[model samples]
Target: MNRRHFLGSSGGLLAGLALPTLASAAVAAPSATGSAASSSAGGRGYRPVVTLGGRTLGFRLNNGVKEFHLIAEEVEQEVAPGMSARFWGYNGGSPGPTIEAVEGDTVRIFVSNRLPEHTTIHWHGLLLPNGMDGVGGLNQPQIKPGETFRYEFRLTKSGTFMYHPHADETLQMAQGMMGLFIVHPKNARERPVDRDYAFLLASYKIDPGTRRPDPSEMTDFNLWTFNSRTFPAIPPLLARTGERVRIRVGNLTMTNHPIHLHGHDFRVTGTDGGWIPAAAQWPEVTTDVAVGQMRVIEFIANAPGDWAFHCHKSHHTMGPMGHGVPNLVGVDQKAATAKLEKLFDGQHYMEMGSSGMAEMQDMAAMGSMMPLPTNTLPMMTGEGPFGPIEMGGMFTTLKVRDSLAPNDERDPGWYTHPQGSVANKVDPKRTDGLPR
Candidate 1:
């Protein structure tokens, strides 16, 4: 069978088997209501899906169905504290707004195309009629600029999904046209979570002197983001200790990210296909989210502290940097610096990369003496209590504390450790090596 036919047949077969199980589970579980219930209106009772600097899209009730409105437009967004880009996105922000819905409910999403180009929103990983699957010409007509398109469908299953343009997908998605679409289970009390959060991993390659992101870039991306914001600027996730936490991660970047969380071991609870069976779940401290994929990780917030949550790739933690710089490690530049300094009377040049490369970050954080190219983020930004953190992209902190409010998502500042709980400087005079 061809690809389309295969997908159609598989979708039908899965729906036939899955719908009954989902329905039976709904009947067996007690009806959840109020704040604990998953409702189409207001997403009440559901743990708020944190989007960092972004906001969730709200809906209005029309008869029994939920109605949502979206607008595609050009946006100038700050990817980090020092970098901003002009890109096309839905609503007013890049990565758009989070769309929340409940299973078994019909949702009517009206997308108004205000972008300069025609577009269509493909409901990634959603089960819907082929006609409602918003592919530009394959499934439906393209939503031309200045036109509005409506997609009405019943959510058959609840899971983490995404929405991005299928028309001119390469350029549109690369320019930042995407959003998170979450479907809460009809039987809300089945799997309970105290704190739920979601973020999309997106990367961009903005040429050093330009403010626009290049959609044609397939590799050598410079800017990395979580919901389009870099570390320090990316808001910290706050939670009370002992609470059940769920983090929904979606990767739209060209590369995979091994997201690591300090102080906790989490389980791969769900994926775009739906929740993983309990028997199949695996515990991991780091989970690799691959391109065009979604991963839902869950864990108990038993540790109380500000823990680092970031991509395990060391280079991914840093911001936009020159990839062409020649390796200077172990190279003696003292003579060259001395001659340069003498040539330029009052100038002093500092050699780098002998002891370590940390000084480069220190210099960048102190503000480069020379102005950086437009739309480029400093390779290292954000200050820590001790000194410069020397990190930037795809980084944030998961702050778990006993004193934090259950629903509080604000930054609680830095953690204060008890006396003797933190590492201290050691004296060399008192230390004697037993073995060389």
Candidate 2:
């Protein structure tokens, strides 16, 4: 989004303009909260959180309270290069901007409803006055379209939380109305991390060649995402070697995700309730984040490489893989290809899935001949320097390198392995690194 979208000096904001330029590639989440590379930039004595594929929400001071404005509106959100969908979100993006504040700070939030119907923001897992809890009808009246509602509360705890609609939740949330709310401890004397990252896991079931997501589909969702984006589009999490890295993940989808990290063991240091005390934490390579819950994990980025970080559920790492496709594996389709060609009057037809779907990676190379539908991403991924990356959706890499500019969040591209370290051919015809 343009800086003008949220750079208001005063609490004043423009009328709710909810239709995001859905194909706009630049807006997602912030590279780092409070500016991680520039310590103490967004907060005092506290490291900023990095919302992958997102940016942090900026605020203004009003009297003694921190004031913010969130416009609930419709958006055209890009899931990847070839896919865009009609989504509803705060501001202009899905998994709306991260809100960073300190515990004990008084906050007054103005929510403008630009949505077609009534909406309310339920502060999931935060203890606050009943009226400020944002449960639509129970705690307060719904913010009807074109109306603005105010929520004032003092942060009583520090943790990773979320905010989404409490009214017409099934339709609203399924349309991608959500964002992360992060509160830091106020004391400021605690251990600070070198690189802190946060993101929300979301899923969509947009049919192939469609522009709007289906909110009614309960299961069999095909498009999984990190901050409403798929792999090759979602930027990698960058860090300096040996840095103490913190990653906060929240799940809004109905299913659970066993989030796994490659080349590092981390400890679960926080949850939806609050930060976990040191004595209670343990080391693990993967942690499960359940529906409507959050988990904070931390570890030393001692290893240097482009390490894989993603959900462990195999299907979650793929795109638009709708259920019930014909099981054509192990069936030789060369004869079928000839028949297809004959039926098409000599137009070449390529066989797919008989030898498994890996051939789809070369779909781009084949160009117009491939039968992929419009407005859908391929199940696999974009090309790495080596070849097709065998992943997508809810997946990204943590690029920990020995040399990176302080606070730099740009993708460093592919990792170059030392010559002898990469696997090589072992037959006699192979290069004679060792005596053949």
Candidate 3:
């Protein structure tokens, strides 16, 4: 879709997430000076090739981020005994792996297309070389099936970024094929927080009639999720009360998402790699994640209830099964629906009965029986700690358990201790610390 189409399709800019026009960014033309330099630097560069399917495609991991291969392949997963459908994935699953690296590190990624159609991988919200931006045929050409493309750049700045097919982005991304990239800072902080969690929040637009994904439909973003699965299917982000927690957010949708967390206003520490000191950090009840953007915030899990964290876009918290258009049938069907309505009587987005009630009822009905797939927080749709509205299918609880030891039992918000904190990670100041 063109720029106009993307923005307009979302019914104008999402409340507070309007982007500066591309013209204002002055990116309409490539800098001749930089292109010349990038060309010369291209030769003899470390050719890091990753095989796509069976063909080895080459790429270079320049700065520090290790280059990996991202392939969009179609896989058939058994959702039921005899029910199977093709799913789009990166590496292998939807909301791909979390790529952890340090700030100021250069990373390269080789993208190979194995699908039957053309696609591109956009490094959502990453500041990289124009050629590596992954806008098919805009900055570079589309990677046709069986073709290989290299994306090389430095993680000069980092916070949270994601990769997803830019071509037919609405469709490709909706079918899955998204992943996270986290760049750590060279100057590590001695914070007391114990755990770090990266969230891949995405919403899928599924046609209610077919109960399948339809990227072409502009207003059907039906299922909202975290890490591809709904709650119950995913685990909770539990920690002891008063423990510090860091949550990195990656929003890959075309619309902005206001992620609301019940009972806490976490201090935002960083925005896409640049650090805002503690003094500058502010506590907000709801953090806004703009389309194709990233933000990192920290909070103390001091509350004790089953706190709900989900997109404020009411519809996003629902699934296709639950968001059915009301049927103006006979009074019997309507009465049965009215009885079901009592279940969500005091819940959110449950006002205007038929229009809103049918969808949720259908979603709950479908999810109640269908086996939930993965169990990672934030939960994907059709899974765990689901549906009290905000906490329903769209949320997973933060089950904070009291702990005095630094064990896996303790939920370390944003800290990962590998080999005693100096594991495979390298200090950005050191050249040979980690490979680019």
Candidate 4:
């Protein structure tokens, strides 16, 4: 049988496979007189956590406990400019909201399941009791539809982590159910950072002329995303020059992502496992985040410019595309096009990819001539300063400026390059003795 047939037949078996048994334990007692808020008051100062264009998860204070609520439901989200998709997420956004807390503080997170199916939130890389691990039918009971479950745990460690459904793992995650969980160190002075940001890397396979993403896609994924958003829509990481910047990235996709930043060499400061010692850390321009893992990278924002930060995998930077298109790269279609144009009025066809594929951008800019299915994005998009960037998925910029307003999180627009800094064609008149 073919792969599709085998997958269809074994879907039920895969869903029924039992997860590893986890030891059940009683919930940890709340801290006596839980007033650790004063510890963060003047001692370490408030760490200004950034989430690019994303919002941080807010909490209510109840008897010295940081209480948060997350509701799992369906949401219609814009992946990029002019493109939107219906996704399953928490609190109405994919890659749900960023959850932030201070190390050593007690947090009470309440997850209400509004999805049609059961779900649970596994605090990825967090040190918590087995019963509160959020694995359905393994650690605790699944949060059924319309039911609420409470998970109380202490932030014993400080680092970047992730949260996603442990039940119906494949379909749920592919449908955009995930979030970033951050724990700041109590003593911010120990590892101080001027700007801290985090985002989750996810992928989806949305076939042409379709609105819903295919969750059963194992290898070929077309829509690569950052926090469930594509290029122009993915918010820029803004920072002031000379500031110490920390970017935490988590990968929930099936494939690994080798993220590369253009103008800086950064160090892998932390990982899902824990913090990497300063002595053992090495400088890298690109760091590979494996599946189900997270990596924290730090760098000094000394470069004052708009630099590209994106997945090194070239195809990951593209939007939804058909996989069965014919390869017209080196083909000479002039004669064929001439014959076809005679049959149609005012129709022009160009064979692309002969001299490097810049024409692909033009085609993308033209938009679809045929009507596409509802809620589907174009194969390529994203308007840039120069023109159509011809890029869509898994792409964003790190904009470092000399100065920015206090608490400014807005996109400062494109940068102004210094004189002679931009690339241009060499003058033919100046090439006196060059090879002709």
Candidate 5:
């Protein structure tokens, strides 16, 4: 299997999201430069969605209708550094390019199936004619291999929506065949935002040294991801301080994720149903996104700092690790280490988790830990300014800075604190009104 990594730039430009083999790769989304996704459409301003490690699907205006193309194909998705798996997705990437348009716009999506099996796309949460429902046999025909099909619908309302295969529903989606479909209101001013971002939540059970995701494993998913990529490998979302940032998250995995963000109290401004009324909106630091659901949260980026953003589930924030390992905490491994060292010529002797698993990460970081299998990532890894971040999986930072240029999606790096603002250690023996 070939190894791959996500595309990122050192400067302000954000790269497009698509594997090399995508059919519609020519028409890619705009590179992130720190600007709202707004454009002039029919004399009205339209804000385009920015997908994390993905592209916003572009369209062609033909006779007043926006036309888009989708190609269902195989993709080798890099879950994180040193880890990857074969997945099925649209336009050559799992959690395919985001489909965006405006309310009251007539959009025609041409889906071409290039996979070995037949597939059909179900436009989740869109009100349309029953024939356009795309439920394989229930309403429409399955798109056979090498065959193309079209789905046309009028956008009756604007909200957060999604699209996935309703054909094999099980094995297909389990292999990561999903994407977001966002419809901006006809009037961009209705729900204006400074920075709008989107991503899909997906989980896969891929064993170390393997190349394909185990679609059959439901309860034992070991890889949790945002936008088909993991922490350290996933890029941070950038924003200017005091900007109203909107993050739209869609869940396609079997499980739910309680996404939490540090430093801000946001409200669920929108759901799959529609935008929530202001009176009904409630402030929350974390929101639970269930399977086949979507949530949109918005907040003012008043705090200029790198805020931790991730799933609340502790296990969901870790990479590949043995779940059946024995509990060795507090065990006396001094004698065992000697015996094992002599048996293995003192080369393979090491105490694992004798005190805690955190030490294991330190050992690994120092290159003294046992070797991991090929294509495997450390369970807990990430270097921070102070020390190790001690996190993985669906983890990233919302970097809010006071000096980011408009649409400059470049990482602003670590936040520097002012004098007397950082926590300092106090002498334990003689401390006066200081932290002890």
Candidate 6:
């Protein structure tokens, strides 16, 4: 966190500070509205929806994942064309759903607090039990708002894990609530792969004059993501040239992500639970994952096209903070001004000035004024073969495939393409063959 604790945290200079009015309010909800907020008075009919290959297990909240209470509304469509407006979600868009479960099963949930305060539900790196380890008031109590907790556990370790609001978790995970859970380890063995994707690396910090979506109580986080959209927004990762994929990396912020992938070099094989005995597999090409970490990679899609994964730090691939403001050329403005002048040595980046003025700068000078951006490093980032490189902040990609096939072809017209289909066009190879 830096820019001087992002401006001196209470939610940084009172920009919106309401952690239930500074903690201890525990539970609340009453503003009477639309059918008293349906779901037949607090939902969770609980059902794995369908189950296994039929792929099921649906949930929202039943309670205790660390003081639960997710509920961020504000509808209104049209994401482009005139940019329609009204965004923000939790049970819906802006990164919310994609739960799926398997491993040792059991996964029950219930969380129902239509919003107003008191929240919980941390499950960042799954290994449940200490009261489902959600960490609100340090294990339980806080669900308030409309009250409805019940997070049952049991998925003994899985590949990717994440949930949010461990009570003010860096401003309710920067106002979005965050998501993506996936477990699937009842034995997904069948190597040489085919297709499987799940990514949730994150980062956000935008206030270069209220351009909106900014939440840094100071220090790290400067917008960088995937699954919350960032790099060219979303594209790559499609494979079919020699298939063999399975990319499930996770890194739910606090910073630490070194993920590099101009072409290919994977085979870490499971961590956080599910496979790692094949003589302890290891053949990286650039990995480094910390902060609430996770890894279960496996590549061999034989480079088919559209590469450039990301996060190898270098200013998280660039494109913000005054876009090109004072950058005077390369190596990220001389390594962010020599790591912000070895983190001070001469001080002043926010000793408080820029007006709104004085009396609030001392979380250690707002956390050393600035320099936490080696791609946001906190829960995981990857780069430990010899240390000093962890900047992946969690990444994406791994689309190799030519026949390790298995699209299961589940209808929906198999993904309608027609109108000048371009014969499935492909040609960008380079997981290691060259010619991206």
Worst 10 residues of 4 by lDDT: 21-30
TM-score attained by model 6:
0.30
Error of 4 at 239 (Å): 1.4
List the candidates ranked by lDDT, beginning with the highest.
5, 2, 1, 4, 3, 6
Quick one: best lDDT, which candidate?
5
* Native RMSD of candidate 3 (Å): 18.3
lDDT of each: 0.78, 0.81, 0.54, 0.77, 0.82, 0.49
List candidate 4 segments past 4 Å from native.
Answer: 1-44, 339-356, 363-374, 429-436
lDDT of 2 by residue, 128-165 (tens): 99999888889999899899888999999998999998
Q: Candidate 4, residues 244-268: lDDT per residue as tens digits?
A: 8889999999999999999999999
Model 3: runs farther than 4 Å from truth? 1-65, 76-85, 190-192, 207-212, 321-324, 327-391, 404-436
Q: Order of candidates by TM-score, top first?
A: 5, 2, 1, 4, 3, 6
RMSD per candidate (Å) reads 9.5, 5.1, 18.3, 11.7, 6.3, 20.8
TM-scores of the models, in the given order? 0.88, 0.89, 0.63, 0.85, 0.91, 0.30
lDDT of 2: 0.81
The pairs that clash in candidate 5 are 33-407, 33-408, 34-407, 34-408, 35-407, 37-47, 37-48, 242-301
TM-score of decoy 5: 0.91
Global Cα lDDT for candidate 4: 0.77
- Report the C-alpha lDDT of model 3 over 374-421, residue by residue, as the tens digit: 321211233223333323335655555454333243333432223553
Model 2 regions lying over 4 Å from their true place: 1-35, 38-43, 363-371, 428-436
| Model 4 alpha-carbon miss at residue 299, Å | 0.9
Model 1 lDDT per residue over 305-347, tens place: 8889999998888888778877888888888889988998948
Position 395, candidate 1: lDDT: 92
